[model samples]
Target chain A: MTYCVGLLLDAGIVLLSDTRTNAGLDNIATYRKMFLFEEPGERAIGIMTAGSLSITQTTMARLTDAIEEGDSPKSIMHAPTMLQVAEIVGGMLSDVTSEVSAKMERMSQNATASMIVAGQRNGGPMRMFLIYPEGNFIEATADTPFLQIGEHKYGKPILDRVIAPGTSLADAEKAVLLSMDSTLRSNLSVGMPLDFAVIEANSLEISRRRRIEADDEGFSRMSAAWSEALRNAFQQIDPI
Target chain B: MTYCVGLLLDAGIVLLSDTRTNAGLDNIATYRKMFLFEEPGERAIGIMTAGSLSITQTTMARLTDAIEEGDSPKSIMHAPTMLQVAEIVGGMLSDVTSEVSAKMERMSQNATASMIVAGQRNGGPMRMFLIYPEGNFIEATADTPFLQIGEHKYGKPILDRVIAPGTSLADAEKAVLLSMDSTLRSNLSVGMPLDFAVIEANSLEISRRRRIEADDEGFSRMSAAWSEALRNAFQQIDPI
Candidate 1:
């Protein structure tokens, strides 16, 4: 299980993801689910993945390999536009999923994954997309400016209420974290430390990147505060 | 998609269910999902359904028929204990599900449904059981005094945060309504009007019952208040 959320706001893009992965209740492990691709001023892309670890890891490795090959059409760094970059990632993800699912077919196991791709290139707009396992994707628009993957429902109400295109980079970060906080409380599978990143609009660079550990004081304080505030809010509603 | 939740508290039990039913987005209708049985002063049982409507309807019908037949062992009203009442409901639900699935098997359609059974008999302890389609069930305990079925995740966080065995009946009512409010906001399949019922512990009868319509002023007020309070709560947390 995993929980990853990405927001494409006017100020920037915000992405957050948990690190826990498990094959079963007893086979739990922590694995980084967020990948950052940066060429400093040239381009910066953040990819947060959910679903099969094998498929996502392989997809990430292939994307990195394509980038290291230098100026290849398949490399996201050299892609002409953010749309093209999404196409490349979606294509690679679909291929990896098909291959993995084929191999696991005999065991009746499913191998599929999806990703949130958000970034900007030198003169392009800050854009974000949710890439599905079938290689298809959807872009975030002003009306719906956020995308979430894995263990999403428990945390969705807050995002549904608070997020919009004009929301500030600071508030967007808070919304995603509080959203993640709700998920963490209800679901044992989505664990910490968390990987968080923000890309300022038009910057073509990752402005802020953070890894929030379970014991991190700031994250703890915010989570506790959110819980207390929620209880207070709940109490404020009149009983029918 | 549907949403129904039941809680067993020291004060009694709280049960709530939405009235929406749909075959698909285009094919939607209103259908009651909560049924109450009370030989008032003797026992009070509330059965909330989710999943296949055909199966649930049949199960409820059979239970009603058995009760009307007067003192049959299969009749929940005649069952010696609340556990036996659960068994009767579970067995009927499981049988209906199997029969319906057999009829739908050629089209590869599933016909399973689940239920939350909560109430108390004249001499029995207040109890609530979640009955699965397989005719097996699990009772709620002090550690986890709630049961939910159908599109449950969106509504779960509030219940997890606020509900406990010692919670007062009024608070329990508020918790379930707010929980349903979250689900209604996130899921189009769970709609209004809602059916709510409460039974006081050791009373052997329902204490309160209400039908909350879409225009129900008090419910609308609470829903609006909850959204506003949540936004305020979200703003109160410090940004990282």
Candidate 2:
């Protein structure tokens, strides 16, 4: 299981992804799930993937291969807008998923994957999308300005109630971390050393990238604070 | 979709269930998912249902019928121990599920249902069980002292972090309400007018049952407070 979230905020985009991947309980491993594509001042995109590692890796490889094909790259870097970039990523992910699912079927296994792609291009608005396994996608709008992939439900409540387009970039990042923290507490399959990134609006450059480990002091502090607040709130409620 | 949760604590047990039943987004109606059977001071059983409403309703009716059986009451009141009561409920629920599934299959439908049964008999220890579609069930233990059925993921995080065998009964109730509150916010398929019940250890009877409506003031206040805390926490975090 994986938990990757992307938020579209007034100031920028915040992206976070867990690094744990497992074929079975005993076959756990850490694999970075976020991929960054940047041409410095030209374009910057961050993708956080979940589901089948095979499909996501392949899709991301294809995207990178295209970016490197820069005698006029035809990937997200060269796309006219973020929407087109989403279309390209969606198509690539879907294709890879179908191919991997077919191979996994031979062993009676299942292939499932999805990706969260967000960034700013030279000429387009900073955008965020939840690209499904089927190659179709939906963009974040003002009303619901964030998208999540992989083991989403455990963390969805916080996202739904608090995230919006007007949310500050700082708040948005905290929201995604808290959301991820929720998932981490509930699911053993999703462990840490997280991959986090931020892309300032109109910057056309990835502003920040972080690898948040399990023992990271900031995260530990945040979790403790949240738990204390919850305990406090629970005590305040009128008893039955 | 339904959301039903049961917590086994030193103080006793807490059972919570939402009442909304929907065939799809457009067709929804209210139906209580909780049923209580108490031969006060002798025993108290709280059955919270999720999944196929038809199968669950039938299962609940069967349990009630068994309790009212004069000659051979396969009832919680008559059972020698809490475990016996669990077996009776599990067997009946399993039987009803298969019968309904067979009938539904003939009409091109599916039968999927699950339940959380929490109860205590006068001479037995308090136990909470999660009965599966197949009728097999598992009791909560010290390490995992809670079970949730139907659309569980959305509300699971809070429970995972907050619930424990030693958790105060008052805290347990608040934990579940907050959990239900989270599920309600994220999954449209799971809705309001929830039924929440509490069983005090060794009391052999339910101590409280509250019906929280869509506009329940306490819930609204609690949600508002939670959101504010989240926002405040976000603001407190040092920006990256």
Candidate 3:
């Protein structure tokens, strides 16, 4: 299981993802699921993936190969707009899934993978899209300012309560973190070394990116503070 | 889809379920999912169901019929302990599922259901059990004070944050309501009205039973107030 969420707000976009991937209970491994594509002052894109790691890793490899072949139409940097970039990424992911699933067929294994492509073009507004395994995608709306993929349920309540169109980049990040934290505790399939990124509005650059390890001091403190806050909140409520 | 949660706390047991049943996007109907078999003061058993309404409704009807019968081994009231009650409920649910599934096989339908049963048998401590379709059940421990069935993911975060053996009944009720409200907003398949019951500690009887309809003033008020409170909470947190 994986938990990845991207929130589009008035201030900016926030992306968070967990690194834990497993083929089974005992086959656990850590693999980064977030990739950044930025041509500094021109365009910045953050891609977070959840689902089959093989498909996502292969998709990323092909994307990097395209970028390395600078003049190729398949490159993320040369994509005309955020929408096209999403389409390109979706196409690549779908292709990888199809190719890999064919090979895994004899083993009776599934090769499904989904990705969220969030970014901005130099001349366009920031946007976010959730790409499905079938290569289709959906954008965030004013009423639903965020889109989540993989093991989404365990963290949905907080997002429903706290996220909105006008939420600031920082607050959006916190919301996603708390959301990831909730998923981590309730779902063994989703584990640690969380990847988080923030894209400031109008910057066309990746503002901040950090990896939160299992024993990271800041995450520990935040978890403790949130738990204490909840305890206090419960104490203040008049129990019937 | 459905959402039903039962919590065993020191104050009492609170069971809540949303009353919505859907065969598809266009085929949704209002169907109560919470069933009660209480011989007031002697014993009170509250059962909440999720999944195939046919299986659950039939199971509850059988349990009710057995209760109404003067002499029968197939009754919740006649069960020796909370465990026996769960076994009886689970057996009924599994039986109903097998019968219905066989009938629906020609039409290619699946009879699936899950239940959370909470009650006290006069001398037994307030107990809660999650009965599987296979007649297997697990009792709630202090470490896991609650069990949820049906559209459980969306509402799980709140329960994880606030529920415990020490949590007040009022807070527990609020947590479950907010959880259900989250699911109601995110999943079109789960909706109102809702059935809520509170069993006071050692009473062997339900102290309160209420139906919260779509237009219920209090529920509406709570939902609005909660959304507002969340907005306030968001505003209070410094950006990031």
Candidate 4:
């Protein structure tokens, strides 16, 4: 299981993902699930994956290969708009998922994955999308400005209450981290060493990319603060 | 989809269940999911269910029939202890689940249900059991004093943070309600009205039972207050 979230706020886009991946309880491993593509000042795209690692890794490899082949119609870096970038990524993800699932069929195992794709193209509006295994995707809108994939439920209430289109990028980052905190505490499959990135709208550049380790002081302090605040808030509610 | 939670605390037991049942997005109806059986002043048992309607309804009907039989050894009212009561309920639930699943097998449909049983018998300690569809059950312990069924994940983080064996019954009630409030906000399938019940330790009788309609003023107020408090809490958390 994994937990990755992307928020599309008026100020920018915030993305966070856990690094833990496991085939089973005994075969746990840490793998980076966040990928960034940038032609600074031209286009910046962030992709966060959750689900079968094989499929996501293969998809990423193919996307990287396309970018290296420069001018390939499939390369997301050269795509005209954020929408086309999503389409290119989704297409590759769908193809990879089908091939993997076919190979796993004999073993009766599923090999599908989903992704949160968010970024901006010069002169284009900031956009975020949730891509399904079938290659289709849905964009976040003004009313619903966030997308989450994998082990999402335990951490969703806070997002539902705290996020909105006008939320500042800083607050957006806090919301996603706190959401991840709730998930990390409730589930074992989602572990530490988080990849976080902030993309200031219209800049077409990745502003901040940080890897938060298990012992990171700032994160620990923030998580502790959120938990204590929640307890205090809970205590303040009038009993029925 | 449904949401039912049972908490065992030093002061007593608190149980809450949503009243929604659906075959699909377009087919939904209201159905009570909480049941109480008491030989007043002797033993009090509260059962909350989630999953296949056929299986759960049939299990409830059979248990009710056994109770109506008065002297039947299979009757929960005649059970020797709270553990025995859980066994009787689990056995009936497992049998009904199997029968219903077998019947639905022709269409490749699966039928299974789960339950949370909480109560205290005269001279016995307060206990809560989560009965699985396989006739196996696990008791809530001092360290983990809550059992939940149905759409439980969305509401679980709060319980994990605040619930303990020593939590007061009043606080436990607020915790479960706030937990349910989280689920209600996140899931459309888990709806109102709700069924709530409380059993005080050693009382051997349900001290309070209330049906919370969607328009209930106090519940509405509590939900609003909770949302406000949560937002305030979110704002107070130091940004990372």
Candidate 5:
């Protein structure tokens, strides 16, 4: 299981993902699930994936290969808008998923993956999408400015309460981290060494990027503070 | 779908469940998910169920019929210990599930249900078990003194942070209610008109029972207070 969240705030887009991947309890491994496509002032796209590692890795490889070939309509780098980039990624993801799922079907295994694509093109509006295994996708709306994939429920209550289109970029980043923190505490399959990215709206570039290691003092302090705050909050509530 | 939680504390057992049932988004109804069986001074057992309503209702009917027949060993009233009562309930549930599932197989429908059983019989220690659809059950231990059924993840983080065998019954009740509140906010399938009960250890009877309606002022105040507390807590956490 994985836990990744993307928030589309008026100020920017915030994306976060954990790197833990496991085939089973005993076969856990660390694998980066965040892919960045950048053209500095032209375009910047961040893709966070969850589900079958094989499918996601293959999809990423294929997307990268397309970009390297250059000028391909299917390449995210050449896509005219954020929505077109999402379509290109979704198309690649769907193709990879079908190819892998067909082979897995013989053994009754699942090879589907879901992804969150967030970014902007120079003249286009910043956008975020949740792409399903079937390649179809839905964009984040003002009423629901955040999208989450994989092991989502444990971290959802907080996001449901805090995130909004009007939220500041800083607050949106904090919300996604705290959401990831809740998931990490409750789910073993989602672990440390998280990838976080912030894209200031219309900048067409990742304004900030971070790789939070397991022993990062900032993350530890934030996590401890959140826990302590929750305990205090719980204690303050009146007993029935 | 449903969300029910049971917490075993040194002082007592706290059980709470939402009363919503839905076949789909368009077809939803309220159905009681909590069942209480008490011989007052002799024993008290509370069963909170989730999953297929047909299987759970049928299992409840069979257990009621068994108890009505009086002297039978399989009857919860005659069970020698809380563990035995769990076994009796588990057996009935498994039987009903299999019967219902076999018939549903023709239509390719799922017919499985899970339950949380908490109780104490005279001369026995208080116990709580999470009974699986297969009839096997696992008791809550001092290390993990809480059990949840149905849409559990949304409500799990708070319980993991606050619940323990050493927690006070008052605090335990608050924890479960807050947990249910989280689930209600995140899941449309788990809704209002909740059933709550408290059983003091060794008393062999429920000490308190409340049906919290949607319009209950106290519950509404608590919910509002909790949401405010969470938002305040989120704000206090340092940004990453």
Candidate 6:
């Protein structure tokens, strides 16, 4: 299980993801799920994946291979728009999933993966999309400016209440973190050493990126504050 | 689909369930998921069900028939302890589920249901059990004094944060209502009007019962207040 959220706000795009991956309870391991592609000032694309690690890692490798073979039309860095980049990634993800799942079918194993692709190119608007395992995708709009994948239910109420297209970059960051915090409390499969990134629209660069460890003071303080605030709010409600 | 919660608190027991049933988005209807049985001063039992309505309704009918026959060993009303009552209900539920599922298998339909049975009889302590479709059940203990069935994740975080064996009946009621409120907001399959009941320890009778409709003013006010409180709490948290 995993939890990843991406927000498309007026100020910028915010993306966050947990690092835990497990085949089973005893086979737990930490693996980075966020990949950043940038030609600073030209383009910056962030991809956060959830589901089968095999499919996602292979898809990432193929995308990286395309970028390494400079001038390839399929490379995310060369895509004309954010939508095109999502299309290319979705195509690659679908191919990889089909290939892997075909082989795993003999053993009755699943090899599906879903991804959130968000980024911007020079002169283009920042856009976010949730790409399904079948290679189809949906872009976020003003009415629904945020997208989440994996263990999403526990973290969705807050986002539904607080997020909007005009929300500030600062507030968007807080919302995703709190959203992640709720998931962390409710699910054991989603664990820390989280990858967080912020991309200011039109800048074509990641403005802020951090790897929050288990002992990170800022995350700890924010989590403690949120818990305290919730308890206080719960206490304040009129009892039946 | 349905969402039902049962809490075993030191002061008493709290049970709440939504009444929505749907085969699909177009086939939505209201059907009660809660059934109360009491011989005031002798015993008080509440059963809240989720999953296949056919299985649950049939199970309920059989239990009722046993009680009506007077002194049947499998009758919930004649069970010696709350645990025994859970066993009787679980056995009936499993038998009904198996019978229905075997027939439905030809049509590729599901016929499984789960239930939460909570109550106490004279000389017995308060007990709450989550009975599975297989006729097996698990009782709630002090460490985890709450049990939820169907669409549970959306309403679970708050319970994890606030519920305990020592939580007052007033607070327990509030917790379960707020929990139901969260599920209602997140899931379309779980809707109003809802069934709520409270049973005080040693009373052997339902202390309170209410049918909260969509137009209920007190419930509406509480829902609005909760949403406002959550938004305020989200705003108070420091930005990452």
Q: Which candidate, 3 or 4, would have the higher TM-score against the true structure?
A: 4
**Docking quality (DockQ) for each candidate:** 0.88, 0.50, 0.42, 0.91, 0.85, 0.79
Off by over 4 Å in 6: none
Per-prediction fnat:
0.92, 0.41, 0.31, 0.93, 0.80, 0.72
Compared with the true structure, what per-residue lDDT tens digits does model 2 show for residues B52-84? 878888888877777788546576668888787
Ranking by DockQ: 4, 1, 5, 6, 2, 3
Second chain only: TM-score per model? 0.98, 0.95, 0.95, 0.98, 0.98, 0.98
Lowest lDDT block of 10, candidate 1 chain B: B231-240
What local distance difference test score does each model get?
0.93, 0.84, 0.85, 0.93, 0.92, 0.93
Looking at model 4 chain A, which ten-residue stretch has the lowest summed lDDT?
A164-173
What is the C-alpha lDDT profile of model 4 across B1-240, one tens digit per residue? 999999998899999999999999999999999999888889999999999898899999999999999988889888989999999999999889888888899899888999999999998999999999998999999988999999999999999999998999888989999999999999999999999999999999999999999999889999999999988988888876
The stretch of ten residues in a row with the least summed lDDT in candidate 4 chain B is: B231-240
lDDT of 1 at B83: 97
Instruction: Indicate which candidate wins on DockQ.
Output: 4
For each candidate in turn, the TM-score is 0.99, 0.94, 0.94, 0.99, 0.99, 0.98
* Regions of candidate 3 where Cα sits further than 4 Å from its true position: A234-240, B235-240
- Could you give me the TM-score of model 4 versus the true structure? 0.99
Q: Report the lDDT of model 1 for residue A195.
A: 96
Best of the two (4, 6) by DockQ: 4
Scored by lDDT, model 5 comes in at: 0.92
Q: What are the per-residue Cα lDDT tens digits for candidate 3 across A79-176?
A: 89999999899999888888998999989977798999998888899999999998899998888888999999878877887888997666777778
Candidate 1 chain A has its poorest 10 consecutive residues by lDDT at A231-240
Distance from true position, residue B91, model 5, in Å? Answer: 0.8
For DockQ, candidate 4 versus 5, the one ahead is 4
Predicted chain A of model 5: TM-score relative to the true chain A?
Answer: 0.98
The DockQ score of candidate 3 comes to 0.42
User: Against the correct fold, how does model 6 do in TM-score?
Assistant: 0.98
Q: Candidate 3 overall Cα lDDT vs. reference?
A: 0.85
